[model samples]
Target: MTSALDIVFAALADPTRREILRMLLEDDMAVTDVAEPFAMSLAAISKHLAILAAAGLISQEKRGRVKWCKLEPDALRAASVWMQSFGQFEPVNLDAFEAFLAQELHLPTDPEL
Candidate 1:
């Protein structure tokens, strides 16, 4: 069975969908405004938007005669948590690494070299 995480990853796998999400990051936008920068037909952009909505990455609502799309930032919390878990290791210190390498190889650490 496909989990919500799977759906989110699948939705994010498409460049078009990723771009749409980036655009919506600034503010909510009308459906036509979302489609403005793409070369594809409105129907194709709608398909991308549908996938995003299905993944819970975006929410769509009608305002007056126009439909608007908004990014749901919380939808990414799961993915972000999962990804951050892999960052358990401390970041490498380049200077310390260079010193260790020099010691191991019996090389001088002089800046002139």
Candidate 2:
């Protein structure tokens, strides 16, 4: 079985997906509303939502004619516990986060090129 940490890592692998999670954290929103803030297409947003759902980071529901997304806070709590255990993750830094994303995405780092 994939661990909660695995779910977290998978859920956080995409920047747009992360933004979706943060938005859901505020409150559940319909699929269209969730996709409205981004330049991407509705399909792209739905794909991100699928990833979050697969990771158990969020849940989806249909009401009448609209589908909504909601955050699963426990998944975040699990991610936090893993971070706390590592003992080196201080206040979030943009550079560090970008580096982490690059690493995750397998981008060739150009330290000097």
Candidate 3:
């Protein structure tokens, strides 16, 4: 079975969807306004928005006559946490790595630049 993370990642896989998310970061936008920048038809943009909404990455509501899309920033919490777990490890020291490589190859380490 697919997890929520899987759904979110799938929604984010498309460049068009990622651009839509970036636009929503500034403020909520009408469906038409969101569709304005893209060269594709409104129907195609709507499909991308639908996928984002299904992933919980965005929320859509009707304000008067227009449908507005809002970024649900909290929806990224789980994905962020999962990704940050890898950051817990200490970073590799490049100097140490270079020294080790030199030693393994029986090369002399140059102290002077």
TM-scores, one per candidate: 0.75, 0.70, 0.75
Model 1 misplacement above 4 A: 88-113
User: In candidate 2, residue 102 scores what lDDT?
Assistant: 77
Instruction: Look at candidate 1 and tell me the lDDT of residue 5.
Output: 91
CA-lDDT, candidates in order: 0.88, 0.83, 0.87
Q: Write the per-residue lDDT of candidate 3 for residues 1-113, one digit (tens) a residue.
A: 99999999899888789889989999999989999999999999999999999999999999799999999988888887888788753337678767755754457766762
Per-residue error for 61 in candidate 1, Å, reads 0.6
Could you arrange the candidates by lDDT from highest to lowest? 1, 3, 2
TM-score of 1: 0.75
**Which residue runs does candidate 3 get wrong by more than 4 Å?**
88-113
Local accuracy of candidate 2 as per-residue lDDT tens digits, 6-108 = 8679779778897788788789999999999999999999988988888788899999999989998777777787788878676687678668667555677
TM-score of 3: 0.75
- lDDT of residue 31 for candidate 2: 92
Model 3 deviation from the true structure expressed as Cα RMSD, one decimal place: 11.2
